[model samples]
Target: MHTVDHLETLCARAWPALAEVPLGNWWMRAAEGFTGRANSTLTCGDPGMPIPDALKLVQRFARDHGIKPTAHVVNGSPAESGVEAAGWRVDLDHPGGAESLVMTGPLEKFADGVVESRDLPGWWELTAGSEITTAQRHVLGSGPNVCFASIVVDGVVVAAVRGAVVEDVLHVARLAVRPSHRRQGLARRLMGELAGWGLTQGATTCVLQVAEHNEAAIRLYEELGCTEHHRYRYWIPAVS
Candidate 1:
């Protein structure tokens, strides 16, 4: 397939899975939401077009759906070009850093362990320190396509991850382990479990979006045999 075609195909397969939420903006929108809705590039054509045109199209689509446009571009390496041409500020984010060598597999073995359901109120109560608002959690969990899990130890929830299945791909979203449980390989185990669930539900492969600066996540994903697929540009036009 052509470049844009390939990107759209991937987006169509991954976006809904990434967010696993509806597009209604009863709550405010974040830049991350736009990427999750991206799948139109296939229809738009590749090299795509001028940056402004691409931005306009995406922005229009987002707006129509009550979503605010917060554009982002993701490329594999610093050497890659055309990212800027897509109207996004370029930045390199490494998701997984040096925390490699962790083992990954299904969550079945740990299923009997203290895995708990983390709904909006519960998750918000735990992560109120960060920017996670109640609406964000609701949008994430309200959908049938999405589910969130937290591993509890000693009656305290320590590690967590969210999974969304869209099309035939399962996208892993917002995975984190509490500071106390960082080095115990819980994240990997959780990922393995999430991947297993996705596979069982007809997901052919799993994908996720991580920032370039997050070395820890990048390292962990690399260790999991995840490869760089496509780069996306996130554009938030400066308001005139």
Candidate 2:
């Protein structure tokens, strides 16, 4: 088992941002306008300056990249108070939800179906649901030693997932199933396929992030024997 900081570090590597800079120990990341995790400052460690000054740098980095300033902080981190005192508020309107839970367990426990190769016809459409952007392609398709998993039916991809093994941890994301195939366990199977592949790649631990409000996903992860390791939230400047 790894510390919260280590786990967070692994996740950052798994879902890398196109641009990243280190401030003290904090990571300022950006990927055009991909996702919050890709475009937020990971407030994991001390920034080696006053929190408010560090936050100013965070804002500058985000604005420079043409993204709204945001910070990702683990719950209970000492940095939280300083951020709030600086007038940053929790981004309750965040598309992914205000906060997310990091869940983890052994990949072998969830191993099931055979993993498939990358870019199976409808996989991108299913995952993105609309036009895919350069940032999405760069961040999702090109991660550290990444592999994609999919389930096909009648020559069409009905389910898909993205998996990457970073230092023995399998980071799973973007699991999507065709609407017509919902509740048929396709999501679980696709995850299994990814797990099988990750294990082969020397991954023993499986980690994924789910929105705190996503009860259904939480139930699914719990059923897979995944335990909540920690929760994180995004913060943005409070509106005046």
Highest TM-score: give the candidate number. Answer: 2
Residue 210 miss distance in model 1 (angstroms): 0.8
Give me the candidate number with maximum lDDT. Answer: 2
Instruction: Encode model 1's per-residue lDDT on 75-181: one tens digit a residue.
Output: 33221234345444422221222111212223333322333345644444444335764445454554446656666777776777777666665666668788877
* Backbone collisions counted per model: 27, 0
- C-alpha local distance difference test of each model: 0.49, 0.89
